[model samples]
Each structure stands twice: as C-alpha cells, then as structure tokens.
Target: MKFRKVTETDVAKIVEMIADDELGKTRENYQIPLPTEYLIAFENIQADPNQELIILENENFEIIGTLQLSFIQYLTYRGRIRAQIEAVRIRKDKRGFGIGKKMFEWAINRAIERNAHLLQLTTDKKRQKAIKFYEDLGFKATYEGMKMHF
Candidate 1:
C-alpha cells in the first residue's frame, strides 16, 4: 500500500468510503447530486499548510483508505506543536488486514517528521471496536472527550 496527499479527483472515492459504514450512513450524503460543501472543504484543506488530507491506495491504485492530519502550534506543552489525526476511514472490505496499523505507523512517522511533540485523535464513544484498536496501538484514554454540535 502507498499513502499520498489527496487530489481533487479522489474526493468522490473518499466520500464513498466515509458513507459506506453504519455511522457514516447517517452522517454522509453521497447521492447523485453531490454536495458542494465537500468540494469547498477539500479546497480549503488543500490550501492550508497545516492540514493534510491523505489517501491510501493499493498496488492497483485503488483508493482503500484515507485520513486527515492537522498540525497545531500551541503555547501549551512548552509551545510544542501537536499533530491531530481525524477523518480516518478504511474501505469496509479492507479492514483487519493490518492496513489501519500501517496507516497509524505512517501517521506517527509523519508527526515526528513535522516536529510534533504529541499525536492525538478522538473516536466516538459508540465505536468500541475502534477504541480497542487504538488502545492496541498504544493510545491512552486519559481524558474525557466532549463536544457540542451547532
């Protein structure tokens, strides 16, 4: 598998990957008339130096996974920068093949390359399997994650 920055052409596949899952079914819209918001968001992400949207592909160049990483420079932790991983999704048919592990390992190496002192991500409370997967990857559930939707 190979990982690379996402291109405009990959947005449709990424959207499909996100919408294929149970949780995503309720959250994503990928009907005949695609949403402009997705394109707008993709453009914005591409323009931001601190934001990275990555796509993972196999030998046949099929998009199989994707994730976004953002680097934030904060005053906390002695002003160290932190890398936050988000929007991680692997093709439903491609799970349990060590692809996720390889993805995380790549993300960690990327965080280190960016001089980020900490790497972090938050998964939904309903995703127990994902939580365990993260734990197996050495992530600690040290804080409560709370959010409010507008």
Candidate 2:
C-alpha cells in the first residue's frame, strides 16, 4: 500500500470511492465528466500548504482509497497545531483488508511529523463501523459533535 498526494486525474476515482457507500451515495456527485466545482476545490486544496488530499494506491498504483488532512492553527491549547482528517474512504474492494488501519497509522505519523498536538476526525453518526474503527485506533468520544448544514 502507498499513500500519495492526489493528482488532477485522480479526482474522479476519489469521488467514486466516496460515493460508493450508502451515506456517501446521498452526498457525493461521482459521475464522469465531473462537475467543474470538484476541480476548483482540488486546486484550492493543492495550493494550500495546510491541506493534504491523499490517495492510497496498491502495488499496481491503482487508487484504492482517499482522504484529506487539514492542519489547523488556532488560539486554543497555546496555539498548538491540530490535524483534522476528513473525507476518508476506501474502495469497496479494499475494505476489510487492514489497509484503512494502515492509512490512519500513516495519518497519525504525519500529524506527529507536523508537530501537531492532537489528531482529530468527525465521522457521521450513521457510519457505525467507521466510528468503531476509530475507537479501536485509540480515539475517544470525548465530546458531542454538532454541525449546521448550510
């Protein structure tokens, strides 16, 4: 397994993985000739030093997973860095193979490398499996997360 920053051509596949599941199917638009907005967002992320859009590849370099890591600098905690993981998805064929765990391990190491004081992520409550997986990785549900959709 390998983790690398996404290229423009990889956007469609990344969207596909994100849209494969039930909840994702409702939120992601993963069709061919993808909307221009996707590229625009990709460009924004690519240009930001604090954002990392990652693609996970197999031995043949096929994209099997994708995620985004954001390094946030805030006034809290004495201005320590916070690493936030988001949009995490593994290809349907790649699930149950421990690749996801490896991916999170990579993220943890990356957070450490970036001198981040904490690594955090928010998963949809509907995704019970994902929450359990995160818990198994040593994350705790220390607070209730609330969000307002615009």
What TM-score would each prediction reach against the true structure? Answer: 0.97, 0.98
Deviation in Å, model 2, residue 75 alpha carbon:
1.1
Listed per candidate, the RMSD to the true structure in angstroms reads: 0.8, 0.7
lDDT of 2: 0.93
Minimal lDDT window, size 10, model 2:
23-32
How high is the CA lDDT of each candidate model? 0.95, 0.93
Per-residue CA lDDT of model 1 for 54-96, tens digit only, reads: 9999999999999999999999999999999998999989998
Model 1 alpha-carbon drift over 4 Å, by segment: none
lDDT of 1: 0.95
Candidate whose lDDT is highest: 1
Q: How do the residues 33-142 of candidate 2 rate in per-residue lDDT, one tens digit apiece?
A: 99888999999999999999999899999999898999999899998999999998999988999989989999999999999999999988988998999999999999
The clash numbers for all candidates, in the given order, read 0, 0
lDDT of 2 at 68: 96
